[model samples]
Target: MYTLLSGLWKYMFQKDEYCVLILGLDNAGKTTFLEQTKTKFSRNYKGMNLSKITTTVGLNIGTIDVGSARLMFWDLGGQEELQSLWDKYYAESHGVIYVIDSTDEERLSESKIAFEKMITSEVLEGVPLLVLANKQDIETCLSVGDIKTAFSDCAPKIGKRDCLVQPCSALTGNGFRLSTEWLEWLLTVLGSNGISCVM
Candidate 1:
């Protein structure tokens, strides 16, 4: 089940809606980002506390405001048990954010496989993909070029289907705005083209 951390969710939504799915390997900080978003919603995030927050079960839904659009964000757990549920939201996501722990070199091969399988699926074949090369503040993370090489085949071919390989740090808020803005622009463009998607 999903929970809302803010009371302003409903009143804030506009007709131009978009859903962004955040997927990555286990311990990729997907859940932490959502919790930080909750703290941002509460407007009291000075140094932010993460003690009571729990790892996402299978999926969690959160909301964010980007430009004039209300973005519905789904944070998906990347565990073996949840692999089957990936496609369930594939068709729903207009944009995707794939996170990776920058220092985890051992999992690079595994990440490439997960990305390939997800992109090759009939449902996620054409949506815009954002590679959040997360945890960049630390050393030993793969370069953005490295990830692009990993998923070269999955890059978008046209208007709303293109993929952007953006490196970001979920812990320090770096590149977060870019992630939101990219999604906002892509959503606006897609909506104008009559692509009706659900999140």
Candidate 2:
């Protein structure tokens, strides 16, 4: 009877947890986006100073609870050497958020290359993907359509998984609502499909 009551209590109160990865090139604002997301979603979280945030050399982690779902974000370093480590976490992640520095036109191709490699990995197959075209607060950043066009060739590699390229400014918190909503929606879909995201 005690075991049954404990199980019932946990079932009623435990939140379903999911892991999401934030990947991008160096200086693409992956850490900034993670900070903003935590600040916006976690009521008591007062995130760090965005400007003072440095390039992540290893990994930065943050957690936020939305409704009954808890999302654990892994913000990995984007340096070439660090990218090799990304796949080590791919098998465990439920989704991926790839941030692109829209204002850095010179690195667009490079970013696309990394993105293509990430999506093609067999371990990440069927994982939901969110491509954030960040730095939209800059007057000259590329638009969502522009980024999409640049990555159009990779669509076949993306397959039928849930994917979205959203315009956002990590510094200004633009597009966070849509991003989080999509994650919440993923929880619903995964639940219906009997997929377990708990780790």
Top model number, lDDT: 2
Per-residue accuracy of model 1 over 1-199 as CA lDDT, tens digit each: 1336343564365346778788988888887776666556434445346555566678888775545565678998888678678889887777777787767878877877777678777776567666777777676777777766765665543235665566776776665574456555556655664554433
Best by TM-score: 2
User: Among all windows of ten consecutive residues in candidate 1, which has the lowest summed lDDT?
Assistant: 1-10
lDDT of 2 at 107: 92
Model 1 stretches with alpha carbons more than 4 Å out? 1-13, 38-54, 152-160, 175-199
Alpha-carbon lDDT, every model: 0.69, 0.87
Rate residue 92 of model 1 by lDDT.
79
What's the C-alpha lDDT at position 191 in model 1? Answer: 65
RMSD (CA, Å), candidate 1 to true, equals 6.8
Model 2, residue 174: distance off in Å is: 2.3
Q: Alpha carbon lDDT of residue 94, candidate 2? A: 83
For residue 6, give model 2's deviation from the true position in Å. Answer: 0.8
TM per candidate comes to 0.74, 0.93
